[model samples]
Target: MSPEMTRKIFLYGAGGHAKVILELLEVNERRCAGIYDEYGAATQLLGYPVSGNLNDDYKAADSAMIIAVGNNAVRRKLARKLSANWATVIHPSANISSRCTIGNGTVVMAGVSVNSEVRIGDHVIINTNCSVDHDCVLANYVHISPNVALAGNVQVGEGTHVGIGATIIQGIKIGKWATIGAGSVIIRDVPDYAVVVGNPGRILRMNEPEDVAGK
Candidate 1:
């Protein structure tokens, strides 16, 4: 469909990430119906009304929604609770190849470069200034933070978060829910729930139940 025909969207968060998503929607000429943030008491956000909590029924039948939360797990959980009418917002400045397949509820932010044959799954966030190389596979709810670089053939599993400025070498397979720390250089495969850090990325620890409790 033409950019002019983009549908109205409702955002599920009202913080900093939602603000960026709002700008993305604006660049594409899409309108936001409102925002839903359970913790926020503000009556409006970026000129749009702050609606009720996310669980409150969405009134507009034609409107789509996106989980604007930056946390990968929260976004994934919220997405599962909502209807299938999810919006994919791509900033006008992003360079996404026509050969790439982007799934619903994904957001491609400004200055991002997605190369040919990349497969981005549902509710993924390809954050600002990131570069995803050809043939990369990003599974559902993955968040590639700002300036992260993934070489060709890299595979990132569901709910993984590659922190800002991290670089993943070619053909590396990052397992589900892994966290690659900011500025780390990933040269090897990572297992599920592993948290890696440092210039040459090393597994710091697995994400245990206690670790999640602290967050």
Candidate 2:
């Protein structure tokens, strides 16, 4: 097997997102040692054994891991609990420009298109079928949900969650810990911790500081 294919990696989720990530790993020919989930009841996932609880010591220091949880807050919490080397999983079907920089622990899902000079931060999730245009900057722990479209030069701050089918206009800046509701079309700058919705993307509410404290 090729060197890249021979690398063993562990996954820290067993839900739908994990299943998709597992498929990505398989298609890339990387070996998945097992899956870990704190709440898992089943003994297996997608034919791979569900090894044990998420907190259990696996003792595979050489192996890397990816946080496959879809919830941005939960994923961020889980990321801090582990000190293992993180793995970046990119689906082969995704078209990513060579000029783009993806940080460690990021996952680029199937059918996603990331254009040139985009800077994606650590532990970020660029979910299925999303299109990120050139020069977009996504901060750490950000989650761009499925079918989201980010126009060129858009800046998404840390821990922000861009909901599914949301579209941001070019040069818009979404603030930290904000939430863009599903199907919203952003045409203006969003303030920190704001929850925005609707076609033109109006602010519905501001997420309190206490709500985003730990995450």
Candidate 3:
């Protein structure tokens, strides 16, 4: 591994998302000095010590960090608090076009494809097997779940969760904190905090508890 690959760092979460990031750290040959989670009292993750607080010591020990929280809002909030340099994590197997601009603290998981002119904002999660086509703009803290397909020029707002197998048509705009239900086909613009579901994705609720998978 190159020296860059072995750079020391801390993780800012200890949930399921953090576990996946741990695997990535190992693959890149990076050393994880510790993990900090306000909710995690556990001592270790994959044998790395878990530090409870986001201390000055932890922040000063490393120059890089990955926000491994699944909830986009929480991740963004903590990221601002840490204020460390954001590290983008792209799996080696992912195919991202040269024209794509991925902002810091983003993770492009395996089998994901980001086409030309795609602008991915900070702390976003583009999970496995997702396809983001040309001219798409994903704002900060957006989570595109596995098997989701975003057609061209789709604008996803901040902290939105596009659930598994969701299909967003071209030129559609999804608003901030909106929940796109699993297997829904969104053919139109969705308003902020709307929970839309079903074929063609009609608005089911507004400003509701996000877990549209249960709806």
List candidate 3 stretches off by more than 4 Å. Answer: 1-6, 208-215
Number of clashes recorded per candidate: 0, 0, 0
Q: Write the per-residue lDDT of candidate 2 for residues 5-103, one digit (tens) a residue.
A: 565788988888888889989888888987887777867888988855564343465577888887777777877878877888899999999999999
Q: State in Å the error of residue 37, model 1.
A: 1.3
Q: Cα RMSD (Å) per model?
A: 2.5, 1.9, 3.5
Cα TM-score per model: 0.92, 0.92, 0.90
State candidate 3's TM-score: 0.90
lDDT tens readout by residue for model 1, 1-215: 86424666789988899989988888887878778988777677788788665653443556788898898888877776676488888888899999999999999999999999999999999999999999999999899999999999999998899999999999999998889999999999999899999979999999873343223
Between which residue pairs do clashes occur in model 3?
none
- Give the lDDT of residue 204 in candidate 1: 99
Off by over 4 Å in 2: 1-5, 54-61, 213-215
Better of 2 and 3 by TM-score: 2
Tens digits of per-residue lDDT, candidate 3, 68-126, equal 88987678677777767667778877899999999888888889999999999998999
Clashing pairs in 1: none
**Candidate 3 global lDDT:** 0.85
Q: Name the better of 1 and 2 by lDDT.
A: 2
lDDT of each: 0.87, 0.88, 0.85
